[model samples]
Target chain A: MKKTCPNPAFLGFLIATAILVAIPGLSYVKQRAPETIIPGPGVTRRGSLSDYLPALKGTSADTPVFYLEGKEPGGTVLLVGGAHPNEPAGFIAPLIVVERGVAQKGRVIVVPYANGSAISHTEPLEGSPASFSLKNKAGETRVFRVGSRLSNPLDQWPDPALYVNEKGQVLSGSEMRNLNRAFPGKADGSITEQIAYAIMEIIRREKADISIDFHEASPEYTTVNAIVAHEKSLELAAEVAMYLEFDDIPITLEQSPKNLNGLSHREWGDYSDTLPFLFEAANPFMGRLRGKTDETLIIEGKDPYYLAAAKAKRLNVPYDEKGLPLSYRVARHITAFRYVLDTYNTYYEEKAIIVTDLPEYEEMAYRNLGDFLN
Target chain B: MKKRVFLLAFTLVFAILVIANGPAVPKLAEPVMITTAGQSAGAAMMKVLFTKSNIKDFVFEKLVTADEIEGYETLVIVAGASSKGLGAAGIDFDGETQRVTALIEAAKKQGMKVVVAQIEGAARRGTSSDQLFSLFVPMSDWVIIVRDADSDGFFTNLCEEHGIPLTIVEKSIEVSAQLNAVFE
Candidate 1:
């Protein structure tokens, strides 16, 4: 039992390894804390996805479902956000709705984090900022994570060779973790599919008259600044688009192709009675021609590359020196959602879902986006 | 004073607008049959415009065929190609072209006025859309388009060459007012 002294270099190496591991480990754990959502006075009850599907109970896949039930009973309208957590406008718009929107008629159900697992981690190797902060109306700084578009591999491991979704559409293996492509999901499928199944359950059980999923796309994407609505929802979508034009917010109305399967606008309409619609706003930060990948780009949405591309007539949506800021994008989504409800009320007066207190587009875009947040 | 100059300038501009009111837009008959040449959402927007304009005697058939135009007095073909929309309608570009061509020919043979419109602006303009516009605009009796759609003066030039009456609206919503002026 000589008990020789430990090698100094080896000890030094162990300390270095510990410091390296601990630093990232702490940062990774910090991201697991979900963003805070304070439901407004219009929120009559709080629920979770587990309430619709018991299997999701106590799992990270489960997320909050805030219900704004009006005093007068009417139809249900489901609003989903954060389906792809990397799209910040999709997540932030619903947060504002839940914290500020008041349901004057029918019901409004807001799901700010439709895929909790996706918001728990950042995409690997993207060099994205982990979180961004905004100051609320109370002047308190609220920090929100900029998570990955796909579910964490830790939650659902081992991507398949190819993903044939529930609708039999073939996609790449990595899309197995994409909740948007997992609609009408199997009850015993992957965690992402389970999340989809739970959302589908909400739409089916709630007898939702209208379901809208907010999304954002790169400025160069063809679908940017458009509303993809199912055939059943086309008339309402068309009316809403016209109303948006009257408000000076020009948006394209795209009929959801029946051939495109497994999407919220497609499968949700086919599988359930809900007339589904999805909105996409142009985000320069998400464009392939973006210059810097950082928090400022995400918030400010200014990129010289996009400006050059716009000048070249290479981008889909209009781009200029003014840039499309996060507030404008969020305002577009919220305003479009409001119009959808208004149009629905006009067409289906008996099953109206009239909401109030939502921020106006000009006011929200002119002021800070966080001013509407709680 | 600056006030007098400003007032005089404003009056001069007003007089110019009143004097140079542009060419008269041709009156289109009611009982209009609205259909899509490329199956784009502009057809739906046209339907809304007709409804909002209080034009009560129009029928909107997104895929109206040649035979369906027999009873209509006017054929409004909204020309903007959307590959997605064509696919959803279970037709290719050539098939859509043939169908619309036949429908327009039938309408022309019956002495029905034809109005071709492009309302969605630059987003709906492309090679296929231009082809669709070329097919419909030259044969049309009148053309109505948003200013954004003719940024390069494509529609204006085509209308000019064809000697067709064209109404260029500043916005899609303005199309309703134009529709009212044409049909009222």
Candidate 2:
């Protein structure tokens, strides 16, 4: 080699190749792949939102829908998540249902990402991380993105100076991008509005007997850890609340106001035959008084500011050192959903939706969520 | 070979320095002084004034006196100024007769550009006709109103009757552009 050494160019190429080879090995950090959910024995088929609304095809609005049919013919119910993607409990609780639930009497449909585009991006000014990961009992980790409350600006830009909702209520212009505010949406409207319209169409076409939209709110908000139901669904919601109260879960029941326009609970009830219910879990991460915003805060739900605020008796939800962890919130949502379903069955046997494999709030709190995840 | 290598290193350093220095320009300007009227009906509109356009320098303060007008080139007196608080402050309020005359004369003498933003919807509390006509309608050189014509009846009628120059802005972000058109 000494005698047959090539030109400097040859040596440079060898050195560069060596550097490139070393870089990959040195920089290789273990990245957990997205969780592979094993649909429970009840899941009959898997489809996409695009199947119901073709306009969503090939777009981020398109997402997976898990269909669980019972052995006997009965009414169908729909569960939607990720309407506001920042609320992880909204999406993850439904995912748990899809992965493990067993529909025994009626059909249960789940859309884990109701607004898929919202899940692709995070709020810009909020300083929120793009993604967080959780490890299951088998040491398999799943990563999920924390997204904005509104549709991605990239998908719909140039917000109107003022946005008038379907009810003719004027709101801040940026509110036009909020999927929650785009209910009873128009086919010719913006992408967010179309997504809303598509959801409405799905509910109307499916004749969903009961529709539940899962969400979370800041702990400081009065509506935190409550269930807001349309006027028609209030009695069932009250029954569910009473049941949850006996379990010491402490859930509040709110009646969706008549004047509030374009909200899912309001418009979904007004426009469709489905009984609309929206669940709100307490999320300290969404509060203004949270500490460093990281996966720890999002998953653990502990914040010193909230701790102080709790001591001052300012928070709407009770807070302790244990914090309102994701596991607890997710479990609360699952429990609420189960109770609502049970109550529906009691009141309207013809449209009853029975599902199993849902872990109780106590089990989730004690054993942790990792034990249940596949 | 050594000389060439040294020259290459020097050239790289020079290039880095040039890149780091960037283009020459003035430093970013400080925020402008903003004074809001207490009885005004446009908190939302005033909030937009901060977010709109490239105008980043806006400092909000409650309107005090003609002497307090210092550090601000423009004054925005929203609807209900005359009847609600201006009259209480000993300012003249004779329908549109005396209040507009005093406000216009005062603003001109103070070298402040007056912006009259039309009130939209009902006031959070209540308003008076004297406030609408005396303070907002005739005195303001520039008028900004919402696209919804029916939100404010008094302001709409006055603008229509007198043919005053009015800008219909839908989004609050447009306020920045409007301000830039006047001040920038």
TM-score (0 to 1) for chain A, all models? 0.97, 0.90
- lDDT string for model 1 (A268-318, tens) is 999999999999999987777888889888888889999999999998888
> What's the distance in Å from true for residue B1, model 1?
44
Error of 1 at A214 (Å): 0.2
Looking at model 2 chain A, report the run of 10 residues with the lowest lDDT sum: A26-35
TM-scores for every predicted model: 0.93, 0.62
- CA error at residue A154 for candidate 2, angstroms: 0.8
| Cα lDDT listed for each candidate | 0.86, 0.70
lDDT per residue (tens digit) for residues B86-172 in model 2 = 332334334333444454466668666666664332222133533454445565556665443234455556655665556654422
Q: Which ten residues in a row have the lowest lDDT in candidate 2 chain B?
A: B19-28
Q: After superposition, how far is residue A1 of candidate 2 from its true place, in Å?
A: 31
